[model samples]
Each structure stands twice: as C-alpha cells, then as structure tokens.
Target: MDTKTFGQTRLLKACAACSVVAALLGCAAPAAQYYPDEEQAIEDEVGAALPPGSAIVEFTTNSAAVAAFQQRVGDKLCEPDAQHIAARVRRREIPSEVQQNFRGLANFLSLGALAQIEKLPKTKIAHYPANQPIAFAATAYITDGTCGPLFLQFTPQAAKRYSLSMDFNGQSCRLGIREMDESTQTRPVKHSRWRCAEGFLGIGKPTLIGPDEIN
Candidate 1:
C-alpha cells in the first residue's frame, strides 16, 4: 500500500483502540498533570512483582514529543485507571487563525502553564518484567480535537536496557521501542526498533506474526 494509505489505516486502527481505551480508562476528563511519575512510583511499591533479574526500560519522553503538541492524550501505561493530559488551552478565547500565527505565545499563555507545566520532564524510567507480556499505549492529540492512540504489547529481555519513544508526524504516529545493546565498547552498541504485535485491550487486529520482539 502507499504511504498515505498506510498512514490512514494505522491512524484508524489507533483511533479505534483509543476509543476503547478511553472508555475503560476514564479518559473523559484529562488530568491536570502530564506524566504519571508518582503513579509509577506507587506501582513499584504496590503494583506487580517483576521476576528476578528483570531489566530496565525507559521512555525517551513521558509527555508528548512537543509540549501540548498532542493536545489531549491518555497516560502511557496502557493500563486501566491511568491519567490523561488535557493540554488545556482556552482556544475559544483565541481565534484559530491567531493560534496558528502565534504558536509560542499561545503555548506560553495556556492555563496548563499556570499550573507549572514548565516543570514537566521529557523522560521516564521503569523496571520491566522480562519474558512477559507488557502492554503500552500512546495517543497523539492533534489540533482540532483529533487524536491518534496506539496500544501495543511486548516483552522485555532480562538484563537488557530498552528505550522507547513515540512521535507524531501528520499522517501517522509511531511508537518505537528498541533494546539498547549492551555489548562491550570494543564493538559499537546498536539499538534497532522492535515491533509489538499484540493488542493489549482489544486494540489491533493482529496483522503481525512473531515473538522475536520479546527479546
């Protein structure tokens, strides 16, 4: 299929998944905060128990690639009861034409900023269970109330560090997860994006085949 077609298809799938997730996760109201840093910390104290020797996985970003770039989105864990960020801006107060014309000004003067959103971070680290199904979700809230959400499930390898990032560029938003090769410096370390085929919560139709991603 062509690039546009592929993008549209992916976006459709993501939106479908996003709706199901929104219903299950109570996404009707967006959280004032961005990342679930405190939530994750609480999880460590009382969530799930990881197998011995579980490795680490870090998100290159806890929030959207651009602050408020994804206008409104749910939490990243892909689990129920996760928080959502509602990049609150009185867009009604400012004309759309003006917003398009003065992007930085609009961002700086948002009600969310008054809550000290400037203190938000772009990265998050977590302890992941190895060789087990782990679910994750990301939604890119585009302008004009359009949002794309993708839910994926994969497993991490023991003793390996994984890095994951999500980006949205118009047609499609991609969630790229890669294992950071821990090879000695004698050989250059490499990190290649892996694929997650499983649908965490009735999301994708499973067009993928392979457990290779678990490693």
Candidate 2:
C-alpha cells in the first residue's frame, strides 16, 4: 500500500482498538452499590432490639429532674428497660432530662444508621481505634432538634462499650455507652451515663463524618 493509505489504515485500526478497549472498560466498571429499604434494614437489625416504638426524643436542660430520674433508673439504664424508659419520657411521665439521655443514645444509633445510609469515616481517635465522628454540619434528624454547629462523637471503649458526647441547649454531657445484649429480649441498642460539663464536649472520637460514608 502507498504511504498515505498505509498511514490511514493504521490510524483506523488504532481507533478501532481504542473503541474496543473503551467498551471493555465500560463493561468492567463496578455496579453501583444499593441498599434498598435501608430504613427497614435498620428497623430489623437495630430497631427490633429497641423497645417497641422507641425513637429519637428531644433534649432539655432540666438537671435536677434528669438527675432524679437517673437515680430512679440506676442500673436499669444498662438493662433492656431503655425502650420502656424512653416511652415514659415520650409520654411526659418522666422529666426531659431522662429523655435527653435517651435522645442522645437514639441519636447515636441514628448516626450509625446514617453512617450505613451514607459513608462515614472510620478513623483512630484518642485511645480508640476506628472511631466515628459526626460533624455539626451533617447533623440531621439524628440530632432530634438539638442546636446545631454541634459535633457528635462515638468511640468504642471495649467490645460493646462506647462513649458519646455533644453540647446542645446550654448543657454539655459525655455519655458512657453500652450496647444491648443481642441474645436478650430487652435488646436495647445502647445505654449511656451522663456527666455534666462546662463547655463544648471534647472530641472523643476523632473519626470524621464526611463523604466517606457514601464512597
């Protein structure tokens, strides 16, 4: 073949080869991951363990009432009674302080659910490894109407122990976390202890909450 014809032929072959590779790459591309019915998944895996009708409640600044309720609940706080306790708070049978703790715990679980719904970071924070920190901006239904520009941190203390901290509504509290026993009927997802503090709760879990949950 003449030089120009040969060059044209080579060019056409190269273009065809490029097209084939592009097609193969498109075929090899990963399928999008979808978690359909996530809410149901949460209800099944986590919510089922909670007391029936358990949900995120609002937080308030009534320390005396909260403290009193804390004393009343005492060890029951760590038990499966969380849902029952939360129900009392919802019914206004208990003071807001108790609800505040339950709300925080609910929000914490909601944050975990949110993490699964989105992509949240798993990083090392303090002495805890693979901690998750939810930023103020990302705060949503998980906060349960708490004031924003707030940060929520969750750090695993042990096998089932975790810690949560947040400052909202003029009060600061660090919650000592406990996960419900999966084998038990109570099946509470978490139990927490509240200690009052002065300012913003320090960053307990350094893992950042961001697009990592999605990616």
Candidate 3:
C-alpha cells in the first residue's frame, strides 16, 4: 500500500480504539448503579405483596442484641421510645409499658433500618396489635453465607394481623411474620430442606412474601 494510505489507516484505527475505550469508561458508573436497582427489582418481584413498612431485620452475632439478650430479649431489641416501658417491665412495674413498646417496635425498628436501605421511602405508619407469638430456632447466615443457629421469637402487631412467612436458605433461615393468631407455635418449622434465594428467607423466598399471600 502507498505510504499515505497506510498512514490514514493507522489514524482511523487509533480513533476507533479511543472511541471504544471512552464508551466503556462512560458506562462503568451506570453499570455499577444498575446492580442495586436490579437487586431491588428482584426483591420486589419476590417481595411484591409485602405490605408497605414491612422489613427484614438481621440479628447477627455482631449485632448489639447479642449482649442485650443476656439481660432480656425484649429489652435488647427494644426501641428507644420503648425504653421507659421496658424498664418498667424489668422493674416489675406496670406491664402497660410492655404493650406500648411492643407496638412501637413494629414501627420504630423497621423504620430505622428502612431509612438506611436505599429506595425504600420512610413512613409513619402505626404498629399492628400484638398477635400470637411464634418462637423458633433458626440458622442465620452472614452476608458471605456462613451461618449459625439463632433462637428467635416473632410477635405480630395487632392492626396487621399475624401470619408466618419463611424463606429458606439452605440450613439457614430468614424469618418474618404478619399478624399473629392463636395458632402460633413454639416449635419451628424445619428449614433445612428448603432452598430459597440468598437474602430472602421463609415462605417468601427472595421477596419474603409468602406464596399464598402473593397474587
């Protein structure tokens, strides 16, 4: 080929390479942001029917609750607004504070966590009434999927009514409950056999909404 033609060809190839690199660099930020939205979409698809204000509370060994549990589970998870009421209970004073704090927790704890979660808007919804209590032993996994047993008790708020929803993650479990009823039990449903998506547990799988409750 002529020298002039060869020079022109090299210039065009260099321009094309630069354009491709620029395009890829431009897409990097958007691609990173898209993953979170993608995860949310997956969660919404799985958790679609979850009533507004519902949340996934993680109580790990690293959580403050571990220390508090030695004193009292109720106190450990108690909301700040509920502290006075919880103190009354520990002091063997009026138990009225117990119910108030219990109700407050459904809103307080959920809202606090939801605030830090991207995309979920905050709301001032009232707590459901205390329904029946469901107690169970669970294997709670870390973000890396390593897990250990955790004994948990879920008490549904009154206004919402109580129903249990479990999404399984191998031997681990993520537990959530709707309104509680007289049927709540102390024995946990066996979760070792169930396989659910990571981050979602109980009957809801990825979204955490029970299959029966979903459309």
Candidate 4:
C-alpha cells in the first residue's frame, strides 16, 4: 500500500479504538453510582428491620424447631402429587421494610455464594419479634441456587398468625397465614395457604399459594 494510505488507515483504527473505550466507560459510570446507591438503601432497610438494641435469638441447625420446619417443607416439595403452585391464597404483600432487609443482606454475597447458602443442610434462625415472636432464618438450596434467608413473624392473637418472608437471591416471597401446625412431634397434617408476592430479591407482585409450594 502507499505510505499516505497506510497512515490514514492507522489513524482510523486508533480513532475507532478510542470510541470503543469511551463507550465502555460511559456504561460503567451508571453502574458505579448504582452500586453505592443500592448499598446505602440496603443499609437503611437493615437498620429498620433490626434496629439498635432490638433483642434477638439465634437458632442453629440442631434446633428441633428448625429441623421440623425444614423437614415439613421438604416433604411437601418431594411429594409426587405436588404441584408448582403460584404464590396465592390469603395473599399478603410483604412490607417494604422486610424487602429491604433481604436486598441489603444479599448485596454482600455473589451469585455463586448465594447458591451455596441455599443448599446448606442447616439453617441459622435469628428471632427478632415485636409484640409477637419473629424469626429470620437463612438456608442453602438448589434450583436457582442461592443463599437467601426466610422471615417468619407470628401474631399475638389466640389463633396465631404467621408472616413468612424469604428472599432467594433476587427472588422474594412473603406469605401470611392465620396458623400452621406448630407442634414439633409431627409433620403438619394440614397445609397453610399463604398470600405472597414474588419479585427480584424483595421486589415483585403478590400471589397466593400453600407454604409447601415454596422451593
């Protein structure tokens, strides 16, 4: 090729490379700001969920209550006749405060680590209740594999109602019910219907389903 033609070609290539770099930098800018903003929001929510000086009780894998609850869920999910029920029943949407807690906690873990969290045989329950007993638990599971926690808050009434909340990576669900067999001696004979909302780690639309429907 001629010298002039070669020089022009080099100049064009350099300009193209610069343009590509500029485009990448532009895209990265929003993400850089986005992460910090999200992190701050999460922190604010966590503070609200477990405020300063709030009392909390932690339950390990060995806890009989935790073991029974896990087995109860496992039995339903393993049933051959089990159906993939959509979140719907009494249909209680999760409070914004609870949603924020999951988002904040998950922000600290990567997708791979989240998956491992779900499948771990044991669950760690952190009970923090107001007016009634509230328990928050984390477990590892396979499916969309991720490490996420579940929240269960009981009501003070005689019938005893429960608000079961969970965040699976970005997938979140909150189920509310009047009662579930709390007896530790046996698996629940009857299923509890819950109204739930599913979305990205605490953000989504509400639906209804039985507690056994959660996976």
Judged by lDDT, which candidate is best? 1
Query: Per-residue alpha-carbon lDDT of model 2 for 96-182, expressed as tens digits?
Result: 333334443443544444223222211111222223321111111112122222222232323232212221112332221223343
Per-model TM-score versus the true fold: 0.43, 0.18, 0.20, 0.21
Task: For candidate 1, give the lDDT.
Answer: 0.40
Against the reference, the lDDT scores of all candidates come to: 0.40, 0.23, 0.26, 0.27
Q: Give the distance in Å from residue 193's predicted Cα in candidate 4 to where it truly belongs.
A: 7.3
- Best candidate, TM-score-wise? 1
* Candidate number that wins on lDDT, 2 or 4: 4
Candidate 2 residues lying further than 4 Å off, grouped into runs, are 1-39, 42-138, 141-147, 161-178, 183-215
Task: Give per-residue lDDT, candidate 2, residue 188.
Answer: 24
Candidate 4 lDDT over 27-135, as tens digits, reads: 2232111112122111011232544334332222211111112211222222313333112111112224333445434423343433333233222223333354332
Counting clashing residue pairs in each candidate, in order, gives 0, 5, 19, 21
Off by over 4 Å in 3: 1-34, 41-130, 140-145, 160-215
Native-to-model Cα distance after best TM-score fit, residue 82 in candidate 3, in Å: 33
Give candidate 3's TM-score.
Answer: 0.20
lDDT of 1 at 58: 55
